[model samples]
Target: MAGEVGKPNGSGGLGFKGSQIPHIKFTKLFINGEFVDAVRGRTFETIDPRTGEVIAMIAEGDKEDVDLAVKAAREAFDHGRWPRMSGYERSRILMKFADLIDENIEELAALDTVDAGKLFSWGKTVDIPHGAALLRYYAGAADKIHGEVLKMSGEYQGITLLEPIGVVGAIIPWNFPTNILFMKLAPALAAGCTIIIKPAEQTPLSALFYANLAKQAGIPDGVVNVITGYGPTAGAAICSHMDIDSVSFTGSTEVGRLVMQAAAASNLKTVSLELGGKSPIIIFNDADVDKAAELALLGVVHNKGEICVASSRVFVQEGIYEELEKKLVEKAKAWTVGDPFDPTTNHGPQVDKKQFEKILSYIEHGKVEGATLLTGGKPVGTKGYYIQPTIFADVKDDMTIARDEIFGPVMALMKFKTVEEAIQRANSTRYGLAAGIVTKDLNIANTVSRSIRAGIIWINCYFAFDSDCPYGGYKGSGFGRDLGLDALHKYLQVKSVVTPIYNSPWL
Candidate 1:
């Protein structure tokens, strides 16, 4: 590994001051440990959602680039040292990768803030650190891949081996790019699979930077590759590529369906998708109104409400509905929306103009559907794609805001009377990514937790994530898991070897 680069000596914040800013590096397609231009020399501008300014002209990868990346990844899986090395050896390399990420955490965080319009402090504190920790966690699990020994009944011995599924194509969404990328990459690496990652064009800078860091961490050439492009061309190629063994995608349900279709049409590769969600946060009558209101606000407002599991639908029991709504409005007003670089800013602009326009349209739909707008229904400023945190009350289950996966800072508030009604309303959406319940009664909490069809159930907290905990979804939210030991299985295939005890069989 190369010597560590010196950390930038600034205010350690992303705020613009005195002409100091983090440098941008690694903008090209990363393949076989080399950064190169696209074959056709096509480039697309990555815009900063904060000011609607062009951040950088990133190399645009297409089907050709995807083919090249997949070929490289296939070669790496077939003949390279990465897949052939022992699990402990891979563990050391992955651990070094995690350490390097820690060393350059500030730079990576800044890149994500600029590219994804994420809060700078959150990028620095939560995204980068948590990503590094997840890498280490998967690194620790590298040598722990085990298979069961089955005892045959007819004097036969069977030994199962869990082997790498070969090349993996991981397509990650723009929201939470760093965290989501690592969530896919770490487990695949731990499972000894070579990967070709396609980061969303909206936020490709951080993934490219991580590719450079992986090289510095002594990861072999072609073991890890990153291709930055639009979903239609580069992404479709990955899904349909015959050489790729698995496709793990994290994005909208619409795109996930297309990916599944492509995979089935081409190679029938294994697909693990963590798709869209309109998750519900149920506030019971027995819950603490203040705490419930705070969590409900955070549930929909965090990351400018771009998370896959954002509890956008809030179900409050009629008994405490008015009080919780008032408290949520107060909390919403307190959330500062400003420059992402500013450390004091809790909210940032939307990722791009398209998302911004879509959110505004949903707000309009809420009004057209007769949902009462309690607070925040307009864009924050004229320059950037910033929408004020929006909340709608009296939202019917059939309303557009409540039914659709509006990936924005929009909250749909619905009133429910009984526990049975709350459970039904919570499970009403096709999305079952996550749900939250706030109540003092253990029976209510336990009942709702078991009744909800979502993958993750939070009792009193929102967005509480652990690296070891399995996370996925049910129904339209997609299938398979992302974090924890379960994610490793996505990149592995089980093989069974059998031998006759007396060597008297067909052999």
Candidate 2:
């Protein structure tokens, strides 16, 4: 990394002031490898979540801008050099993109920290590097994409060839903006597909910054485009666009439905959705009390509880329920909530005012529905959208907080008497995105993990994501995987060719 920026961990509670932060440089629609204004010359304010103030004026792209982006992407896919170029050549460009990310990690990290209110250290340590590594991971797969050969019964030969699926439209979520962008973009690029990204309106800074980096890395014109606007306009446009071959979306389950419906209502384009979750962390009596509490609390508190797969519904075994609650209070106290740029701050504010209010309302619902407020359930400060890490005890399965996807750091701690009861309660919700089990017993681990109908399960750990691990959801959480080789395959289409032998009867 060239720029050694960002403050180190210390005892200071204060952070870099708004004036001290890096200036917002890129805030326009990125299409055809150029920074251009929206078609109508309209713009919207991208707010700084930490202060609930406008950070910069970003281009507000609607249907017309999406159309322009799609047109550029279509031309790139049908006639441009990106799709026609050799996989190795494409891989070179992607590798260079990753390299440039490393070179300007400071500016990129600052952009996400200010735009999305993500912890700056987390951006530097995890978000930026992981996203870059995702690029490299997909880069390694670029040249290796291939098909299979088949033998026919009667003097014939058959072979299947894998090819790019053409233009892809990706709708990204506000949380984890950088990571999700690369998660969608890396695989699409590796598969030789031109992509039009509709980043969540709240956090367009990093995506726009990434677009500039993509162009600098020598990614061909029109191969990667970003439209920064709201879902109803830009996102819906991408989903319903006739020319788009496929759409990959990550957000709430309700929005995922809209994306699917639009795709079906339009050209029936392929849609892959990684949607919301009310994931559970089941704690067995055999587990370490502190470790289980840490896992459960961190799972909810990380990213200010803005993540989809937050283990918000925790089912603790009756034997260790009280002890784990005490431990959770201790750990959450130390998990300070403050400005993103503060190195001492482990958690930051919600993505925007809307999300912060939504989380607070859910916390109130937990109380109204008779769930015990174990600890930390109020706003941290007056100015920013910060909420305390709250844990609700004696939470019923039927409670509003337990039932709904409260995408915040509010844990619904419920007690279960038996292993069968634990499994049954954990699988009760409509979401099946992810689940975590903290147990030393091997039999219990195997039994409950296999029984729960979730896409991914963690044993004694949470948020254990890697570039190689396939992450997605089942049931109402929506279908399709994000990372791993499966993501790469989603952007590719398979075609089989058959031929008869010269002296065969078939000819």
Candidate 3:
């Protein structure tokens, strides 16, 4: 399937026959609303994980490039129309941006598929459309930002205003590049803040294209900037920059810690992180075994298990453990692993070679640690970075595969006896990103949902996300929230105004 290339179908869509790929248009760094070369003139190749070939050569941005982007963002925030504009005005422009995204949905979806190795069908049907919807959601939220009048004790009146936090540095991950980018971008824009974004080098094409779309949508120059480069260079610069008022990051917890340290050492800028997870999905004996098994497969195998909130750790009650395990294994074996461009393909390759090797290593470790590999513990084909949808049974809480965030097509199944035991085992890991509960008994669902330490809880459903829902993490998974009104606040700060009544200040 990797050998199949895409050809021009001449119907405004690229066709993938065999070994053909689409050409990428946006590969340069975007600063002050213009696409330009890196100051150092250095470039890096973005690989097509499906074929292990170079898709495009992207400009490599370092501290120098970040400085330029940050300077532009600072100037835009301090002396530009964006932060000072009325919410209604901003909302109109954002609505245009969302419309532009919808207009170019096919190109964006194809870019995500070729660059990130996600299934093309899911990219078109789920990721791209969801991003556009989130943009519209935030657009509606723009005009609703408000301040409140408060009663005061003495002879004074008080009011609190929600102001833009100034320049925001958004560093997004590669797993769901477009989705995560808008998850941060929409709110920041709606809050009337200027931003400098650093996209992961692995999947920088869509972000660059979006930057262009922002310009076409009438976003003013310097309001939105995108720098494409490696994390340690461009990402570190954004984190430690003294001028950036806040930094919102979504990636691994290890990197999230470094971002926090950088923020503290620089200017104590506000930092919001949505980091890694080893989430759990609990299935009680009362759950519909067939449905539970299907959702369990979807939870871990979606996006090839690269999701930050992938429910990698699944706990089934002892009464139905064997039954669920068998069902899950059968579903895993049935999942088709082939060309991402094929609409029927259920799964695609890992994002890159490093991630591919890492997942295989974890599978080996699980085997060595005495867990039973029920199915799919090997690579799929001779070409590409594809791996089988792997599942392990009898996994203990202390096992490496169970404790760590695999971030790949891997699932660890463990058995639990009671609700108390399930909660304990679920919360034992440092991550508290998300959890799922599947049970017909409302009491069991409610009790487990309350006791489990996770940010998002899914009842009998997996990957149920919405634009209005607030999502974030606790513990090692990091802090702050994304989506909903709560996310809007992440890009805003409060200011209080007070005045003494005329001649009534004890004069």
Candidate 4:
């Protein structure tokens, strides 16, 4: 709190807005469950995408730092008292951690909004709060991890024991840093696994800040460590570290592949990747145009369309394509794109300048591929890297816009003739993280949901997520589910304990 600094508003006016809130500076790294300076004593500045100005300076962690953190985590997993604690006791501590997160939600949300340019309403009201809820849920789940008593045929008895998998490395993406980090960490922690967290460099402030809160929450030293640096360096180090027992990564498919390769090369660590998605949203003629348009807009345009399952590819029935397109275009235009601090602003700038350029390039590609630009083709505002919410029509299945994960505020609308064709087009992409279908017909909705080869199927809804639900995808979208009791299995190992009742007879 002492190093916090407030940013100026869009008018460059150092007025009430700037005075109300402040930016933050994180100059130390969290390792061994403590805030300490990096051993190498190096640091880097995090730039604000809106102003292209250095907002905060963070501890720059490299391979040496990664090793130190991993060693601490390994020591905790092997020799520390955490793994030896009762499941109930561990659950109590995790509940405490969740309470701490809720207590400091405002501070954490402010930091996230400043660092990542996400909407404060979302970060404060939704992301941080849900993150805490997940932690609490996992906390309650910790003690409830049950083993089985299996019946044996011979003179022997068998039982299965659920045990921790040891040190885990969780690499989270920039878009939803706190939410995703908590999603991975809560279950791993509840399962008695120590962790080394590598947050996206574009938005590392909140992750590091949350580490401080973890210490305050009674989590033991070395139980949770955060290293803030680029993916290729700190992230790669995490993946390849021999001491790490497993790796859980959420990022682009290309980078996800590297993470897997690194894990395989180092120790063949158990890896769970939640990679990219070219999620599709299909709208049928029977669907309500206004409702479909609303869900469609939320699918791609929400969170600046930076979500992995953004529903970048939208499939509309030809009977209602023109009507739906009009509604979608109008709905998109209604969303205000401006500074995240503005309470009324619906869309915010991309994470950084580079991502802004990449999104622009994709829009250009849409134009080149003959996808008629329906609305929003250019960047908005002069100060920040804000892009206008874009939508394209006449898109073919082969178009690059329809095939690739744009990871921006560009929605490519394609028309399909029949329900079968819609299902086929939705599942055509290499990714299958999520999909949405809008229809009033129960049979059509049920059929389409069953046919889509994605992890989550939304009916007349988009961007719906809950801590209790299972999430993750098949194919290029990556493997391993996150959230709910099912996620707990990923961080635990099943061991069969067998005993011979008639040892004398066998001998």
- Which candidate has the top score in lDDT? 3
Query: What are the Cα lDDT values of the candidates?
Result: 0.89, 0.89, 0.90, 0.85
Tens-place lDDT digits, model 1, residues 6-89: 222111223433123456556688888788788888889888888887777788999999988888898999999998888999
Stretches of model 3 off by over 4 angstroms after superposition:
1-19, 503-507
lDDT per residue for candidate 4 within 189-258, as digits (tens), equals: 9999999999988888888767777777788989999898888889999999998999999999999899
Model 4: per-residue Cα lDDT at residue 297: 89
TM-score for candidate 2, residues paired by index = 0.95
Q: What TM value does model 3 have?
A: 0.96
Model 4 clash tally, residue pairs: 3
In candidate 1 the C-alpha lDDT for residue 329 amounts to 95
Instruction: Tell me model 3's lDDT, rounded to 2 decimals.
Output: 0.90
Cα TM-score per model: 0.95, 0.95, 0.96, 0.95
On lDDT, the stronger of 2 and 3 is: 3
Candidate 1: which stretches are off by over 4 Å? 1-21, 503-507
Please rank every candidate by TM-score, starting with the best. 3, 1, 2, 4
In candidate 3, clashing pairs total 8
RMSD of each: 3.5, 4.8, 4.4, 3.7
